[model samples]
Target chain A: MSATVDVAVIGATGAVGEALVQVLEERDFPLKTLHLLGVDEAVGHSVTFRGKNLRVRAADEFDFANVQVAFFVDEADVTRECLEAVRRGGCAVIDLSAGLPAGQAPIVVADVNPQVMASLKAPYWVSSPAAVSVALSCVLAAIAGQVEVTRASVTACLAVSSRDRQGVTELARQTAELLNARAMEPRLFDRQIAFNLLAQVEEPDNSGHGALERRIGNELKTLLTRPQLKVAVTCIQAPVFFGDSLNVSLQTEAAVDIPAVCAALDASPAIEYVEPGDYPTAVGDAVGQDVIYVGRVRGGIEDEREVNLWITSDNVRKGTAVNAVQLAELLIKDHLSKILT
Target chain B: MSATVDVAVIGATGAVGEALVQVLEERDFPLKTLHLLGVDEAVGHSVTFRGKNLRVRAADEFDFANVQVAFFVDEADVTRECLEAVRRGGCAVIDLSAGLPAGQAPIVVADVNPQVMASLKAPYWVSSPAAVSVALSCVLAAIAGQVEVTRASVTACLAVSSRDRQGVTELARQTAELLNARAMEPRLFDRQIAFNLLAQVEEPDNSGHGALERRIGNELKTLLTRPQLKVAVTCIQAPVFFGDSLNVSLQTEAAVDIPAVCAALDASPAIEYVEPGDYPTAVGDAVGQDVIYVGRVRGGIEDEREVNLWITSDNVRKGTAVNAVQLAELLIKDHLSKILT
Candidate 1:
């Protein structure tokens, strides 16, 4: 455990990838060296890590022979291409793309399901839930423990940063341009991400469940230890740059008292209860935050087993990068580094 | 019925009052002369009606003696003040303020409850539901019918204009000032209200229901012909200027199909079904419309007797003015005008 480990970060230079680098530095992960890989167009370019410039390598040219862990943040197809190579090279793979390993458990949040990583015998992949879903699961688990979650309906107010670095730049550029009396051409999103909210996502199947929804449902089941919990989600892109908010209404098996739920939430370390009287929680307050902010807890109605709450978090950190790094930290702490490496 | 009727509009110069005059003109109500009444500050201001300028008079000095129908658009206290005077003047009073008539039945959306107005005699008072509440009732009636509404959880995306004319002007002035590189001093709303939504409303009573919530509950009871239904509402203010959108989830005794509910909604003349494919119905599209837009109809869960839908409408029109005028039209059609005038 004292020896530093070689890490390969695929999809380096992307939003989540950049955040992963920052998180690795922030947490002071024992890194002997870091290998950055991106598309062929980004090859030979450099990304600064820990005050040193690391040249971006094409996925085809990446030397995974000595890499201990390969963090796959690339697209699903690209991750699929490099999965076998990294695994064959004896590097543990942590895949962040939507692709799931068949018949394998893709651990969701490291804090929620740390034991799931203990059973992995080789370089295995883990799937992170969507930003909103991660934020919601963190919030909901703190309140209604052991309760049957019959339904979960969320209105996701997503940020432009969820799209990637270029999307973040385009959102800021378009918003500033509009503010400076100039016209904007939207390219990152299907609609104008300047001052509007769009509700389209990776298309839903015939059952009206999109890829994000299915991922969230499967991930929540794995994380919460409930495999049959039903989840209905509506994801919408908001005009925010970072952080996403979910307006969640849960139908539990038993009636929940609002005060008791708030007390339980306040006691949880993963949640920071934003005072409901504060009026509204803005994206500015949520940016770069580790703790998910929970507010607006209220009872539903007489004889109805439902409660509503609003949860917000920084998608890049708690939703993706920090979560992945945290899982790696847990693995090291639990003496599973030998297996992972 | 063809004869000219003297009409007195209290709360003139206000948002709903302005829309009331426009609705009357648009519907060609049989008004020989129009008298506008407001507080002392708004007195002497002239508003044009039917291509003619009509001076606004003080509510205290306005001669309600000759007016056939007096519309009270002022606050609840002011409406209570002039209710006796208007009644003593032998005119039928239609109160739009939240003040419910002591013993008279309040009519909500004349098309839905025309008989409530038809039963009115001389000096009888009729009241309409709040804008958001009416929108909710309209949607619920079409979907649930006479089924016992076990519970209703509402999240209102209200507009600043719901407060008064000052709110309307403040939002516009602040938006323009922000666009013009000037600081915005918002007085009507508690917060910025430019690009954010706030959940600040009149504080809830001992039973945890605010004025808007209580009014919505009572109004729905009257309109849906169910007096025992329970409702839980959370009203929030959004950046929109005119329309209010509500995310409503209701539990009923019977199950409802999505298409059947859509058909029921389409069958109702007062509602317009915005298809699921066409969403994000902004305030601009719903400004002057008289119909409530209902869409996003989906099932709740596996065994839950509930459904969710998005409801939006022009607060000034379908929620208030147009509904009042429609009630008056119903009175004329029912030959009840002779009972008052």
Candidate 2:
């Protein structure tokens, strides 16, 4: 394995993409060279990395063979389009766009399912799950030692940034208009998301489950390797701009020990466990942090076997970018030689 | 029963109180006289009823003996202070403050538990549950006809108005401040409530459940008449000005029949069912509506015995005022003579 590897970041101008570059710099990731690539309007935007202005080039024109590993931060359609090229270039791929199916590239959370990486060969392709799934799996995987979860239900309050920068712009515009006593014309979302909760983040299938909701459920199961676990997910679009907050309820085989669960969360490096009396909010505690903020941890009202949790996470940083980087770190630490060969 | 009955609305200056007066006027209740009463700051205000402005008097000095029924909408402390006088006045009490314990005044939702009225005597002291409870019970009770729900978990995304008119003002203030590039100074809520999801609406207890969350759980159990049912409640403060949205997951004894569940929700007069592929939001459909909007109904991804639903309801109108009026109508229809004596 080399001391440093050349890396390319696709979709370098979006929220997650911008954060990916920032996280790589913040963590001082070992990189010999960094290539910023984007598509359409994203191309030519300048992002600051290591005190240098790196201009994003067209992702369509960039040669994937130049980099040892590539982080795909674009939307699923774009990621799907470039998959073959990346494979042909023999570059390892870490997907944050949820483009590749789990069957083709296993969904791996660095802290939760790093073991999955050991089974991969050259031209390694790994997928990072959605932000909600990443936040949930971090805490749930920490507590797997204490309880065997049979069923889990999550109500994820997603930020507008999940829709990209346009979402952030629209929320600010809608809010300003509404505040100044002007009419609100919702743009990015179907309706006004300024100060309201949209029941579904996207249109659902016939079964009444939205695409993101299904993706979250599938990712959690794969990350936990619990195909039989019953996961019910409802993803609502919140007016928030930065972080995602989730209300999770789990049914376990045995009674949940509250203290034990707290201890487990407290010990996890990926989570910051707030005490029972104090809770964490997305804006107040988790907007820019590197770790998921977990609080409001307790048992059920009537059933001892039930456990409820409130988790707040930085949607872009820790949930997506930082996680992808951690996976990259693991690959560089153990599988770098195989990929470089 | 007489042709008309004198009614009094205590704490008639706040959000719920204001909605209560409007509902009474909209419903055209058989009221011989309408009295609007309030506490210190609420006095001197006027509420319009039947096209006439009604002055708000001091609740401390008002005579409960003058009205056959009184709707207590003040805080629990005020409700407690005035309870003795009301009982002595032989006035039928419909408490909305949640001031009285369940043992002292049984919590009742008109549609969910009309039969509980038969168990009451004169000088009725019936309690209206919290807005979240009313909204949830309406939908859950409707589904109880189709499935035997053994457990229910809910994530209630409450609007800012749940804290009263002041909460609404603070969110608007915070949002405007943030939009104009000014610093946010959170007042009503512990932290910024604008464009954020607050994990706990109120301070939680040692067990990590907030007062409102616990109240919702207990109220659901009582309203459903299922003492052994497991209920998990998490009330989050959302940025919305009005309308509360809840993501509810229920576990029934048998596999949930999707068609039957949809039919039951559709048939319920108190609920407005939204078909699959389309959904409702707090601002889009339920701000001032009288019926609770139910949508996103589906089964769990892996568990057949689970059912998930998204519900949006006017916390002030349908949840509190309308439900209270419906209870008043029920009392008038069957037990009016007993109270008028």
Q: List the residue pairs that clash in candidate 1.
A: none
> What lDDT is obtained when candidate 2 is compared to the true structure?
0.89
For each of the candidates, what fraction of the native contacts does it recover?
Answer: 0.11, 0.94
Candidate 1 docks with a DockQ of: 0.27
Cα lDDT tens digits for candidate 1, B226-307: 7767665667655556777677767677775667777888888888886565554544356689888886666554434666
Model 2 chain A is weakest, by summed lDDT over 10 consecutive residues, at A332-341
Task: Report the Cα interface RMSD of each model, rounded to 1 decimal.
Answer: 3.9, 0.9
lDDT of 1 by residue, A27-131 (tens): 899888888998867777887888988888898777688787778787878887876676669666676776546655366676566777766565555666666
Tens digit of per-residue lDDT, candidate 2, span A216-334: 88888889999888899999889999999999999999988989999999999999999987889998999999999999889987788989999999999999999999999888877
Residue pairs that clash (backbone atoms under 3 angstroms), model 2: none
Worst 10 residues of 2 chain B by lDDT: B332-341
Off by over 4 Å in 2: A337-341, B337-341
Predicted candidate 2 versus true structure: per-residue lDDT over B243-303, tens digit per residue: 9999999999999899999999999998999999888998889989999999999998778
